[model samples]
Target: MVSKSSPHKSALKEKEGISQPESIGKNSVAQIIQFRKQQPSAQELIDGILKGDKISLSRAITLVESTQPKHLEKANEIIQACLPYSNNSVRIGITGVPGVGKSTFIEAFGRFLTAFGKKVAVLAVDPSSTISHGSILGDKTRMEELVKDENAYIRPSASGETLGGVARKTRETIILCEACGFDTIIIETVGVGQSETAVHSMVDFFLLLKISGAGDELQGIKRGIMEMADAIVINKADGDNIKKARMAKTEFNRALHLFPPKSSGWQPKVTTCSAITHDGIAEIWEMISEYLILTKDNGYFSERRKDQNQHWLLETINEQLKNHFFEHPEIKNLLEENKKAVHDNEISPFAAASILLEKYFR
Candidate 1:
């Protein structure tokens, strides 16, 4: 079926010195140039996001998370524009010790929400290697069902330069997701010390996913985290594990009752569920709805958000001040010089730090 001078035939016969059209190469180069020249403006990104464009939403989050100084102004502009449309979504923080089925639970819970006509966004934080500063970033691969769903958005961010398995820019990413019409935003944290506190500060509800017979009942979860949890879910409560899960649930409930009353006046609940079997998922969501209603009715919801905003303002100031001190060229030089002196016992650690601080201030 080959024509005498078909382009496909010519391409196949290319080694014979048949001249293919140079237009193809020229056009590709032109397209590349055009793409580079046409980065979307802030308003354009905002418009695309408002129209529920997922690609634009991803780009906006990338912009916010960018470390390049050149992108700062544009990122700020995009955030300011999106701010008017944001803060309407319910933000949930999910955390669990390793092997606790956090991904499975999220897949089940997210799909459940999306089935009822809600758009869900999952911001999963992956821990980066301390040496290489690289992350597996495979959360999407783990949540196969939710990853395939059209109503769901799963963004896995590297927990670089931030401890506790959360990206430094997660709070900003939440705003971008909310502005893009995602009704539910789930924040997954690295289940390490101090990470729960960070996640608790930014979410409407914090849920701790636990499994039964995981050695110790507390399983390294700090007491402060127990005090902050809005709900504790005992996952993997199916097959032969049902009895242990139920016992774990009972124990958790009893322990929760001993904690001081929450400021919201709503008692935290503990329940058992199987993410694989999809059992008791609905009950957990119903509890979430009830908590939302109660908190909203008591006017605690708004107050909590206001308090979070205030907390972030101070947190931002502290982070920026630290970054400025470290990034300063003179301070960097002084630090290296003084750190060596301290290592060799030429100067005390306190004196070295004081010298660096004086140099930073001056």
Candidate 2:
């Protein structure tokens, strides 16, 4: 009661002082204003990315990942310009169950490639939190050695509810990485599950990592994932696990033989590697090189990429159509009501959906 009026007046005066333009330095005020007015140009971004500028490549990727309308338009322009310079890199997709030592294997594998004067780009897709829509996993902290390598570029993207544990813009990010002179692109999916098919669709070579002593050797992995692999490597083939790893490798080789011959006609091979000891890493790479040579010599390499591009075109169209339908303001408004009606047995789900679709179409 004694000092309430004085403190109240003082707080009001302080807020007024803080809100005044003169409270900030002239240069600082101008910089803030300038930031709001500035936007990156697609041509400048394309030029810098093609020149192997990491900063530009990062910014361009952020642009493509943005869902804002203005940024989406610019992102498309940048991609269109980067397309001709893209697809120069060999894209490989890697997956495995949790605790399969994927981070360790990739770190060792990436270092091996850089040691040979190769530029490698690793794009890790982290699982997204359904509630917050933010990445739940942090991949960068796991790949310590690879993160320190000068010739390696690693970008971890949030999966954001995408079915494959891959970001919607990951394929576009690969093109940008290729334009930056990365000869090899490695896309690591969330884990060895529903996301494998998504990664397999985009990569030229699909590598599945497995660890020994997981019950039935191929215990948790789906049969479809086995058929998709070009190569299967059993990790942790060191210390006491070496014997188990070898047996697992032989088991996988037999399992792969049961499947029909792959379209490329290059039989899948099984090998064992120790990420901790860095053994058998080179042999795995040599195997990949042989597969590349065989596919390229037979013209199947380019043909596969062509088919992937066509697949992506149709996939994108489907995604856009769904986005349009769900994001429509009218549909969004009616959705809950129709859902409630169906839940209450007031209307059949099909009839409710049909009513909504009619409203949407008109």
Candidate 3:
């Protein structure tokens, strides 16, 4: 039989060992909570955004983009707090060929808008590697003038594991920008063909920027993007390629006529612009404003926004399900085993996937 004194001493030692660390952990957590409370809350960030403060917008976007667990909770809180003020801005998505001067055009356009007393926020979606899931946030460096402007906010974000050039956080960032009272939100995307669709889905206006003489006019853009574009601007119009730009514009105009009208009932327009000389930037903005006016007047604005919101809800649910499924330890083990089986041809790839999925469902 064990001695009463021995058991009590053992229990006391156990308590001493465990309780001290637990107390320290609790204190540390309490300190962290106190620090967080002393720091800016999401409500304060929203207030700053509504005041058109660029620093606040930057901080809010960073919070939304962070992958940390605590930051995710904070981001959600910030988004919820800002939701009432969001969706009030004109969201425009811009895409173009690799060398078509997307950043330059955005800088010029952003500067132009700021000059006219409009608050503009640029959210650039950098391409991410499918294999490594990394991105080079190069747009902020490229858009030097826009980054320095008091009325303009520039955020370059990564697409991470998302397939589209647009980052998963981009939609949230747009809402934050809108909450901050930015009148216009410009989403810049890598000009990869199908990736532009991601940008198209979230914005009110989808602008396709193309340079003249890149290749055959007909095949310059993939069919899907051309079909989605609200406007196609032929850039490099001010230089020696002015004549070629005109020809390209004519070809695009004719090409656009063949596609079905947009769901918004506003006909797509093709124009020419030179970002190097800052020419036709105002015209492009005017075209966008006109398109917005027409869509809003025809009641398509609200309809499109509603559809986007529903789509976002479904997207969020799907993403969460995917994350949850992948996070399960059993599912992960089965997936690895299945991948090896598929590699070794022990079972057909589809059969392996079905078997693993059955296990997951079970």
Top candidate by TM-score: 1
Error of 2 at 233 (Å): 0.2
Q: Between candidates 2 and 3, which one is better according to lDDT?
A: 2
| Maximum-lDDT candidate | 1
- How would you encode candidate 2's per-residue C-alpha lDDT over 1-362 as one tens digit per residue? 66766644443454545554665878888899998687668999999989998878988898888877788789889888988989898899999987888888999999999999999999998888778787645667898878888899898888876787764599889988998889999998888468888888899999999988887565535788889999999999999999999999888887887889998989999999999999999999999999999999999999999998988888888877887898899899899999888899999999998999899888
TM-score, one value per model: 0.90, 0.88, 0.84
lDDT preference between candidates 1 and 3, better one = 1
**lDDT tens digits by residue: candidate 1, 132-187:** 99989999999988999999999998888786755348888888899999999999
Model 1 residue 322 CA deviation (Å) reads 1.3
The best-first sequence of candidates by TM-score reads 1, 2, 3
So what's the TM-score on candidate 1? Answer: 0.90
lDDT of 3 by residue, 1-362 (tens): 77777734443345434455665687898998897677587778777877877777788788877767678788898888888988888999999878889999999889999998999989887878888878888898999888988888888888776776564588898998888778899998877756687788899999988988887587645788888889999887996888999999988888888888777888898899888898888899899989989999999999999998888888888876777778778999889988998899888988987887788788
Identify the superior model by TM-score, candidate 2 or candidate 3.
2
Clashes of each: 0, 0, 1
Give the per-residue Cα lDDT of candidate 2 at 263.
85
